[model samples]
Each structure stands twice: as structure tokens, then as C-alpha cells.
Target chain A: SQTIHQWPATLVQPVGSPLSLECTVEGTSNPNLYWYRQAAGRGLQLLFYSVGIGQISSEVPQNLSASRPQDRQFILSSKKLLLSDSGFYLCAYERQGAPHEQFFGPGTRLTVL
Target chain B: QQQVKQSPQSLIVQKGGIPIINCAYENTAFDYFPWYQQFPGKGPALLIAIRPDVSEKKEGRFTISFNKSAKQFSLHIMDSQPGDSATYFCAASQITNFGNEKLTFGTGTRLTIIP
Candidate 1:
């Protein structure tokens, strides 16, 4: 069975501070990874997605960036966080071929003050 | 442009009642339609999905009805329970130029089950 892990489960960052959120998937290789953000009572917004190492496609332009440093490791980072960055960040993974059912991690709740 | 649009931003249903959520897409190339359920403070989980080739698919108490010509789909939850109360999201996706998949999500609908 594959499992996805994300941390820290909750984060409180001051405005203009740096941000780093990590996601790792065990028991799967070369999986497609994605980052999504959801505001309270709103739909999810796709931020970035990575097909392979060093390859990332950003959907919306914002204060955040994503990187696939390793095959099973993905990181979401920000140089200086903004107040608008506060939301629930989720990391998901899917297989390479057909029937791509995405599996999500526990997610991180980011609060910027 | 919002590729997918979901209706009834919020729904309240009684236990054992059927709750339906609808979604419509603008892109014809979208071949996959998926519904996700998310609890508070938790990540969204894949609940059910359907391909364009199929008109309907069922899994346990959940069902997805797809209309190819109208580019519309819906999720039906039978005998809803309080545990089923959560936010539901409908999404559409197609194969990208790089062979990767990208999903466009609709505005989520919050479902509350009244016991």
C-alpha cells in the first residue's frame, strides 16, 4: 500500500517570513505530484504540479513555488509569505498511466499573521 | 476561465435521504470526471470517478452519472449519514501536452447531514 506524508500538520508564520512544506510518498516511484490550496469554504486552487524531478508546471501565479527534488519528495516553498497565503495546502500523487486516482496526504494548515 | 462549475454551494439533507450534486464542464477534451470528499482539517479523498465513455458508474452507496453530449456529471449519495457530511468537490482533467494530468476543480459544495 502507498502512503503520502506531509508536514508540518499545522504552521503559523509571520508575514514576510519564509515558508517550506514537504511531501513524500512511499511505495511508489515516478508518480505525478501536485500542490493545491483551499481557502475556508472555497474550492481548491491548483498551484503547481511536477511530472518528474526538476520539472514543474505552475497553474496560478502566486507567492508560492514547488519543486520535485527527488522522485518521491516534493517541496512547496515561498521566499516571503503574504497574508493571502494563509490556507490549507495539500499534496497529492497519482500513478503514471490510466485510471489516475489521486491520493492525498493529511495536508498542512497554514496561518499567516 | 473556470473549466468546471458545481451547483448548490451548500446542501442540507436528512439522514437516509439522497443528496445530489451537479457539475458542468466547458472543455470537451476532458475525459475524466472525479468527485472528492474532504473532511475538516483533512485532505480531499477520491470518492468516485467516471470516464467519458461510460454513462454511469456506481460504487457502494455513491454513483456518478456522466453525460457526454452535455458535458455534465453528477454525484448521488444514497442513505446519507452524518459521517458523510463533508465538503464535496467535482473536478475534470485531461492529458496535458507533456503527458501529465492536470485537474480543474469546481467550487466545492458543503454537505451537511441532519440526523
Candidate 2:
């Protein structure tokens, strides 16, 4: 069975602070990874997706950016955080040739103050 | 058409009652519809899904009713339980030679099961 792990389960950052969240998947190879944000009382919005290492696509323009340095490791980074950046961030993985079923990680809650 | 619309932003039902969540899409290119369930502070989980070729698909206590012509679909929860109280989202995607890489998610419907 495959498992997804995210670090810094919950974070509180001050404005203009740097941000880095990590996501790694185990038991899968060359999986498609995605980053999504969920605001309070709202649906999720896709921020970024990667097909392979160093191949990233931005779904929406934002202060956040995503990078895939390894086959199973993905990182979301920001040089300076904004108040609007506060939200629940989720990382998901899908099998390369499987159906569009997305398996999500536990998620990270970030509060920008 | 890249949007998936869901209605009844919130729903409340008694235990053992049936709760229905409806969703509609504008893109005929979408070939797959999926319903996800999310609890507080948790990631959304795939509850059930259906293909346009099938009218309906059921798994355990969850069911997805799809209408290809109408471009609509719905989720039916049988014998609803309090544990089922959570936010539900409906999504649609098109699968091509590349893959269904992106999914358009609806605004979401919050379901509450009163015990």
C-alpha cells in the first residue's frame, strides 16, 4: 500500500517570512503530484502540479510555488508569505496510468499572521 | 467548460435517512465524475465515482448517479450516520491520451447527519 507524508502538520508564520512545506510519497514511482489549497468554508483550488522531476505546472498565479526535486519528493516554497497565504495546504498523488483517483496526504495548516 | 457546480451548500438529515447531494457540469468532454468527502482538518477522500457510460454506481452505503445527456450527477448516502457528517465535493475530469491530470472541483456541500 502507498502512503503519503507531509511535514510541519501545523505552522504559524509571520508576514514576509519564508515558507517551505514538504511532501513525499512512499510505495509509488513516477507518480503525478499536485498541490491544492483550501480556504475556510471554500472548496479546494489547485495551485501546482508536476508530471515528473523538474516539470511543474501552475494552475493559478499566486505567491506560492512548487518544485519536484525527486521522483517521490515535492516541495512547496515561498520567499515571503502573505496574509492571504493562510489556508490548509494538501499534497496529492495519482498513479501514472491509473484512473483519476487522487490520494491526498494528511495536509498542513498554515496561519499567516 | 471547466466548472463543476454543486448545490445545497449545506444539508441536514436525521440518522438512517437518505441524503442526496447534486452536481452539474457544463463540459461534455468530462468522462469521469467523482465525489469526495472531507472532515474537519482532513484531506478529501474519494467516496465514489462513476463513468458517463454508466447511469449509476454504488459502493457500500454510497451511490453516484450520473446523467450524461443532462450533464449532471448526484451522490446518495443510504442509512446516513452521524459519522458521515462532513463536507462533500463533486468533481469532473476528462481523460485523454495524456491522462485526467486536472480535476475541476465544485464549491462543495456540507452534510450534517443528526443523530
Best by lDDT: 1
All-Cα superposition RMSD per candidate: 1.2, 1.6
**Cα deviation of A25 in candidate 2 (Å)?**
0.2
The CAPRI class of candidate 2 is medium
TM-score of each: 0.96, 0.95
Q: Which tens-of-lDDT digit does each residue in A1-113 have in candidate 1?
A: 79999999999999999999999999888999999998865688889898899999998988899999999999999999999999999999988774458888999999999
Q: Which stretches of candidate 1 lie over 4 Å from their true place?
A: none
Error (Å) of candidate 2 at residue B77 is 0.6
What overall lDDT, based on C-alpha atoms, would model 1 receive against the true structure?
A: 0.92
Quantify all predictions' global Cα lDDT against the true fold: 0.92, 0.90
Which candidate number has the best TM-score? 1
Q: How many clashes in each candidate?
A: 0, 0
